[model samples]
Target: MRAFLPLIALATPLALGACGDPAPTYIDQAWIRLSPNKDTPSAGYFVAHGGDAATRLRGVLTDYALKVEMHESMSEGSGKGAMMTMKPLDSVDIPAKSTVAFAPGGKHLMLWGVNDTAISRGKMTLTFLLANGDRLLVDAIIQKPGADAPAPKADEHKDH
Candidate 1:
């Protein structure tokens, strides 16, 4: 009986590890930068993670803005003004256990014609449309570009 006890203990931990939960297929940490001026558009970013299955991000919808689009920054060619363009995207795939980061000068969500309420200060509910018709509702955290203060850093200590 004593010899069999050791094998049972080892097997218990192995079973637990094999029974771990599956990965998440969702978007989180969604944030948006407030425009420096009312005329300019804002950039939204977030992370997308799909578990063992693959998924794709089709587009986005938000009532606060006139238009929402998935955009990739372009190198301004020899134009009169800043070289940029807004090209329509079909979809973005989210592979299993991988993350997609949307940020400035990258693949990001462009929020145009934001209303007054969402301009200076407010929250906006943006739903990310998936290829599978799964809707992931995300909250866009609003803050003016270089507004009142800088973002607090992890190394920044309160005591200091």
Candidate 2:
């Protein structure tokens, strides 16, 4: 019985560790680049960290913006003939233990008619919907047009 007690103690910790929560899936470094033109939709970017299980980024929602859509930029041709094109994406897959970036020239969010309140606050809350039934709320820093804006890239706002 004493020997069995030692075995049970060792097994207890292993069982607890196995039952621990899975690695967390989350989003961070979120920001929005306001367009130089009010009529043009602004762009949003962020980085998503995958958890123990694979999932998909279904969409983003924000009360500050009238509309939000996920988009991807692609080059259709090669070399000098290369032309950039943008397409809306319904969902983006995120592999387990991986990172996905929504950057200036890659996947991004287009926001139209951002409310004045959010602009004044210089930040806004965004809700990220994941296929794994996770809703992550993150605050995105807002960058208004001018010198502090992100570096200008030809493909960044071609669609807007």
Stretches of model 1 off by over 4 angstroms after superposition: 1-22, 74-86, 147-160
Clashes of 1: 1
Can you tell me which runs of candidate 2 are displaced by over 4 Å? 3-19, 146-160
Candidate 2, residue 152: Cα displacement in angstroms equals 19
> At residue 101, what lDDT does model 2 achieve?
91
* Per-residue alpha-carbon lDDT of candidate 1 for residues 1-160, written as tens digits (9 for 90 to 100): 9999999999999999997776557776667787777688877877786766788999999988998889887776675777776665778888877778776667888888877776555568889888877898876777668644234345422222
Instruction: Give the local distance difference test score of model 2.
Output: 0.89
Clashes of 2: 0
Query: For model 2, what is the error of residue 14's alpha carbon versus the real structure, in angstroms, after optimal superposition?
Result: 8.0
Per-residue accuracy of model 2 over 117-144 as CA lDDT, tens digit each = 9999999999999998989999888998
For each candidate in turn, give its C-alpha RMSD to the true structure in angstroms.
6.0, 7.3
